[model samples]
Target: MIHPRGIKSLFLLMLLFPGFASAQKDWQDFMKQFPDHLDISLLIQDETGEPLFQQHAGKRIPSASIIKIPILISLMEKVDEEHMHLDSLYTLQASDKVGGAGELQHLPEGSRITFRYLAEEMIRISDNTATNILIRTIEMDYIQHWLREYGYEDTQLNRIMMDFKAIEEGRQNYTSPQEINDILIKLWNGAWLNENSRAEIMHWLKGCADNSTIPSQLPAGTVVAHKTGTLDYVRGDAGIILGDKPLILSVFVEKFDSMEEAESAIGQIALKAFRDFGR
Candidate 1:
């Protein structure tokens, strides 16, 4: 007679493999649903290192502000190293002020904000001013080393937060869907950050000020830890969709005719992913 533990193990394996198979098939079907003209790249992978869907997962794209992931990671590492404190104050300067999507810019110069508060603004509201301040305080080489150590060669922050010179030189910033997905997965697993740091990051991401992409199509109660990046006609969202089985996803669309069109396309893709594999 087979052992009781063996029987249980067999049953568990049977239950898990079917869901994996179904997720893969659903992703394949969804890829064929979209038109060929759209310049898009996407990746959906479950927590078990299984890819549910993939399309141009390796292609490089202008990350816009999505490059902030590295900046955020660098900050956390600093906290871990005892070089900084979450509650430590960072005084905003004129150089830190940059034009972008956020409320920090509206605040007058010399506004004092805690590092934790700045991190919240950076992720929650995609605040460029807060991002710049953090970047300025945290060394770029440190951020670059963090990315390389994490095996994210394709994700690079070539310039400080919203540096116009870099933007003008065609080196604004860049990352891949695969890279973003990897970052989100690491963050979700608390591997890239200490326990407290991971919790704080997720809390901020959950309240992301912009959710027009991934969260826009999911159910009301679906928990998504995500970040959205936008500039003119470009739009991108990357995050982990937490449900019964969490799936890491990154969808980037650029060169669209208009922001509205880009958002609609992203919504369609997200809806399909949710309906097909989010079960």
Candidate 2:
């Protein structure tokens, strides 16, 4: 049985994208497999940036490492403008260490690293230490201003990753599925950073080691350039799924009963979209 909210969502999607009515029905029906308690926000667009499906995509929630997307973009913009060089080095400090999904914290202090290395680790491993370093190097205030200037009012990187005190103070980073999809679409269309900058970012994203979300259940050899975000109660994956019909997909699952279940549901939803779009 479709949840009442799902029914309303289906109606709106059909009304918004009439050509996708049949596909929407199939996908929405599959959505019933997820329990009503889970908060799932999703946005799927074709290469042209047309929304094929969405649900609560504009509802902002804790972003986890997904906030890195904007940070990465901010850094790349500086590089494109010749304001920063990827080859430039920044030395690590004891204060820069944080406990989370990265190896940088294990490295000794005083280890000098390049901006390119920091950027790569930030995306490829969701490195909290690298992220904090880049956040400091790029200036958090500028990133906040850039987000507002671009009208991403719902997305903000207010605190460094894995900062427990900040979390206790409620200074968490937040973003919505729609916001992420919009960013990825621009990146896909060459509307954001220069070609080289975008390519470098994509290279890092494609190598991301976390395959437990969107890419978990995909057929082998699928080319997916994406980022995954995880916290105690939030799980998200946003990326460009390349194929005959290239797609931009962002799925964020929050407030779930089980981590395993949440990740499984995300993969199932993405796989369903892959099939729907491939046809």
Candidate 3:
């Protein structure tokens, strides 16, 4: 007859070798399959808003256009308070054009555009000209005050669209991945803006023009509301991961030698984080 101790030993071995071993193997395989030089910062939390994994979470990096999140929020707050109407008209002047990934720069001077369209272009397309007009209309100080009021201690809008002065003064722009994730979580939970405004903001986020990072790795039907910021050697993506479970994730990479390599590294890190914590 078989000894009970032998059976117990085999059971214990199975218990020790399965799930943990599989997890380690999966992580290792991911790391080996994709190798590139980049600074990766990620934060993922569970459906209950508990943190699941974090890497380089506290580091600050140039936000690029991702700083537009607070700008969007601040603008929505004004709409929520009825201080500004979405349909309110703003004239686009020659000085308002900043010349980036947008068509607004090509429009004639003194052309009129509604706030709703400007907000859409700003968030959905990262239109630098539209962002500049909104910033000039709303003012940076007010945006900063809104950030402080919303408990975003680490978030800041230090400049207007393509402002060379601010960039030269060592205050170009910056945000931590953690703070971006925090903002996303609050927005997802309907706490960042009013319920109607929150829904509207998320709707705009869904229309983000850039999708070369996290969205590129996700399945066809996966819903990710994200904003992407790109400079020569820096790429950042921040948004909500909506799946069987909803979580906020922000991955920022900086000082990459090549944009393509940096993007590939960010994609690999995003895929790993999504598979691990996205359920």
Instruction: Report the alpha-carbon TM-score of model 3 versus the true structure.
Output: 0.86
TM-score of each: 0.87, 0.92, 0.86
What would you estimate as the lDDT of candidate 2?
A: 0.86
lDDT of 3 at 39: 62
* lDDT (Cα, tens digit) per residue for candidate 3, span 111-213: 9889999989988889999888788777889998877886666678888777778787888677777677778877788775789899889988989978788
Candidate 2 residue spans exceeding 4 A from truth: 1-19
lDDT of 2 by residue, 8-49 (tens): 765787788776697777778888879999989998878876
What's the distance in Å from true for residue 144, model 3?
0.8
Winning model by lDDT: 2
Instruction: Give the alpha carbon lDDT tens digit for every residue of 1-279 in model 1.
Output: 122433354356447788755655666676666555567788777765455566777788888878887688789888988999999987777767788678888888888889999998899888888887887788777788888887787898888666778888877678898778878877777775789888877788888878788888778888888888887756888887887778788888876777776777777777777776667
Q: Global lDDT of each model?
A: 0.77, 0.86, 0.77
Models sorted by lDDT, best on top = 2, 1, 3
Query: Which regions of candidate 1 are displaced past 4 Å?
Result: 1-29, 32-35
